[model samples]
Each structure stands twice: as C-alpha cells, then as structure tokens.
Target: MNIEKARFNMIEQQIRPWNVLDKDILDMLIVVKRENYFPQDQKTLAFFDTELPLPDGSKAMSPKLEARIVQELGLKKQESVLLIGAASGYLAALLAHMSSHVTVLETSLALKELAEKNLAADGVRNVSVLLADGLSGQHTGSYDVIVIAGAVEAVPETLKKQLNVGGRLLAIVGRLPVMQAELITRSADAAYDTRSVFDTVVAAAPGAVPSSQFKF
Candidate 1:
C-alpha cells in the first residue's frame, strides 16, 4: 500500500468530511501515524472508517471520531489532561502532542502495558499510563481537560468533580444505536455547562455500564 496516499485519503475522505476542520488537528493526524498504534494484524485497518477491535474487547474510536474529539477539546500547550479508557494509547499519543502532560487510565493491565509500549515506541514522553478502572473515578489531582475515549450511558458526577474550574470534559453519552458527543465545561461556583457537539455511537468504555432503565 502507498502509505502516504492512504493517509491523505483518510484525512480528505474520512476525517475532514466529518467536520474536523481544524488545521492543526489535521496536520497532527498526518504527523502521528495511526498505524503505529495498531497491532500488526490490524495495521491495515488503521485509516478505515471503522472501530478497530482491541485485545481487551474494547474498540478504538474511528479516526474521524478521534479527530473530532480532539478538535472539540481545544487543548492548549500547558493544559494537563486525563484520558479514560486508554485502550492501545492512540488517543493518549495524540493528546500528548497537544498538552503539557497526559495521564491515561486503563482497566486492563495488559492493555496498560500495550499502551505504554506503543507510546514509548512512538517517543511520546508526556504521557503516563496507569492501570485503573475508568468508571471508578478514583484518582489524585484534577485536570484541565478530561476525555472519555468511549461512550457511556451518562457522565458520572464523580468524574465531573475531577475537572478544574474552567476545565472541559468530552464524552459520548447515551445508549446503543445513538449517542451524543458532548462537551461539558466547569465554571466558577462549581457550575457546569454542557453542549451537545454531535451525534454518533461507539462502544462503551470498559466498566462504564449503562444505567438500568425503569419500566412503567
């Protein structure tokens, strides 16, 4: 395969059309080789518009979705970021380039190791991969940005509390078949404002089970 051509096609045909118009983000996608984050067997699917399956039964969000999420975050060079559901560290690798520091929380120990390996191989030095349940929301220190790498039925309040004032949290919320990607910002006086950015469905982060629905 013509690697550069394929990359360009992915940007033009897939990502750009998904409303990911940020030039910096588009450039970053070119710089960070998505194929490097995938396992050998799945490398061919790197630029395809589909979620790639991971060993832990999780799925990496499509390239367009990943780019859209990053673009929506509007990250600054000095902001600290927390990434839930690290998966194979592709998103963390991307976030590391745009933020001062990044901490990735993963539920699977094997996946954590895989993430560390991939990040290190890519020379991503600003990220720390930790083995922790993403749904638990137990961690030290607050962050200027938090990105949940997958969908959840709802954004737990515990996770919202971990964001610093003026910080933003991005996540896909709702059930299967449809979901809304939302950006929630924390303001002074402990208030939060949420705005729906787009509608799409992706696999739920491990441990982020949907809340039970009551029947009439």
Candidate 2:
C-alpha cells in the first residue's frame, strides 16, 4: 500500500468531509503517524473509517470521530489534558501535539503498556499513560481539557468538577443504537454549558457506569 497516499485519502475522504475543517487539527492528523500506534495486526485499518480493535478488547474511536473530538475540544498549546481510555495511545499522541501535556487513564494493563510503548516509540514525550480506572473520578489535579474516548451513559459530576474553570470536556453520551457526542465547557465555578456536537455510536469504555434507573 502507498502509505502517504492512503493517509491523504483518509484525511480528504473520511476526516475532512466529516466537518473537521480546522487547519491545525488537519495538519496534526498528518503529523501524528497513526499507523505507528495501531496493534500489529490492525495496521492496515489505521486510516479506515472504522473503530479499530485494541489489545484489551476496547475499540479505538474512528478517524473522523477522533478528528471531530479534537476539533470540538479546541485544545491550546498551553493547556493540559486528561484523556480517559488509552486504547492505542493514538488519541493521546494527538492531544499531546495540541496541548502542553496529556495524562491518559486506562483500566487495562495490556492497553496501558501498549500505549506507553507506542507513545515512546513515536517520541511523544508530552503524554503519560496511567493504569487506573479513569471513570472513578479520583483523578488528581485539574485540567484544561478532558476527553472520554468512548461512549458512556452520562458524564459524572465528579469528573466534571476536575476541570479547570474554563476547561472543556468531550464525551459520547447515551446507550445502544445511537449516542450524542457532547462538548461541555465549564463556564464558571459552578456553571457549565453543554452542546451536542454530533450523534454516533461507539463502544463503551471499560467500567463506564450507566445512568440511574430513576428519572425526573
């Protein structure tokens, strides 16, 4: 396969048409060698418009979805990011390029090691992968951005509080056939604004909790 051609095709065909028009983000997609982060057997699917399987059985978000998330988050070079689910470290690498630092949380040891190996091999020094349950809401320190790389029933309030006053969070929320991709911005000490970016269904993050039975 012509690697560069394939990569370009992915950007033009899959990512660009999906409304990922940010030039910095589009350039980052080219700079971040995604095939390097894929599991050995899945390298061929790196640029395909599908969620690639990870060693831990979790799914890496598709190319377009990943691009959209990054665009919506609008990461700044001075910002710090907390990324949940280090499936392949691809997203972390992308976040690292757009932010000053990235702390990735993962519950799967296999995935943690894989992420570390990939990030190091790619010389992505700004990312740190931690083997921990990210959904537990026990993460230390505040962040300018938080990304839940999988579908969840809802974003926990505790997790929301971990964001700095002007932080932004991207999470795929809902269950089953369809889900909404939401971008939440912390506007003030106790106020937050959420906007639904798009709707798509992806795999769920490990240990992701569902919404309660009762409804208002």
Candidate 3:
C-alpha cells in the first residue's frame, strides 16, 4: 500500500465526513499506520468503512469511528487515559501517542492477548492492558481522560468516578441507530455534564450492563 496517500485519503474521506478536524489528530492517524496493527492476513481491510473481526466476540471499530473518538478526546500530553474495550490494542496504540499513560480494560481474554501482541508489535510502551469488564469500571488508577471504544446504554457511574476532577470521558451512549458520541466532563460539585459530539454506531461492549430501559 502507498501508505501516505492511503492515509491522506482515509482522513479526508472517511474521518472528515465523520467530523474529525484536528490537524494534529489527523496527522497522528497517518503516522500511526492502522494497517500495522491489524493481523497480517487482514491488513488490506484496515482502511475500510466497517468493523473488522477480532478475537472473542469482539470487533474493532471502523477506522472512521476510531478516528472520531480519538479526535474527540482532545488529549493532552500531560494526561493519563483509560480506554475501555481495548479490542486489538490498535486504538490503545493511538491513545499512547497522545497521552502520558494508558490503561486499557478488555472483557475478553482472547482479545486481551490480541491487544498485547498488537501493542507489542507497534512498540507501544506506556499502555497497561488488562482483562476486565468495562461496565464495572474496575481501575488500576485514576485518569485525566477516559476513552471508551464501544457504546453502552449509559456510562457506568464507576467509570465516571475514575475520572479526576475536571477530567473528561468520551463514550457512545443510547440505542442503536440513535446513538451519539458524548463527552462527559466532571464538575466542581462532583457531578457530570454530558453533550453529544456526533452520531455513530459500533458494537457495544461484550459485558456492558445495560440500563433498565434496555431490559424487556
């Protein structure tokens, strides 16, 4: 693949239409080489506009979805981050470039292994990959930013609590075909304020505990 041209096309065609515009975030998407993170046999599918299968019952979010979320994080070099649903560590690798440290929580042991191998392959060093149920929001430590790679009925209160005061968590909330990417920020009163960034859809976390409204 002519990586540079493909990268440019990916950003301009796939991600820009999705509303990702930060030049730095755009540049990072090119530099990180998404194809490098995919299985060798599946490298050609890296830039497609659909989710790619992963180990366990999981799927990597489409390239555009991943770019959109990373762009929305508005990461800072001084901040630590939490990433739910590490998938194959591709998104985790991208997060590592923009944060001081990243703790990725995965629910599937199979995906945890894929993430470990992919992260290692990419030489991403500051990420701690662990297998944990994201809806439960188990933590290794607090973070200045939390980026959940999948959608859920709602952001777990536990994950919200893991954010430092003034920290932000980016996630997809609400039901299919109607979900929106939301940014939740911590307020002085220890409450959270959320707003929609863009409309999107991805596979929900495997073990995400849905809200009562989702139960039938």
lDDT of 3 by residue, 1-216 (tens): 776777777778888887787888888897888998787787877888878888675688888888778888788999999888878788888889999999888778888888888888888899998878766645546889998787788788888988898889998888767888899998754789889998877778757765764556
lDDT of 1 at 110: 78
What does candidate 1 score on TM? 0.95
- The whole-model lDDT of each prediction reads 0.89, 0.90, 0.83
Candidate 3 C-alpha error for residue 112, in Å = 0.8
Residue pairs with clashing backbones, model 1? none
Error of 3 at 142 (Å): 1.2
What are the per-residue Cα lDDT tens digits for candidate 1 across 1-216?
Answer: 877888999999999999999999999999999999988888878989998888777778899998999999999999999999888888998898899999888888878998999999999999998888766767756899999888888898888988999999999999878899999999875799999999998888767866774244
User: In model 3, what are the clashing residue pairs, if there are any?
Assistant: none
Pick by TM-score: 2 or 3, better one: 2
- Candidate 3: worst-modelled 10 consecutive residues by lDDT: 206-215
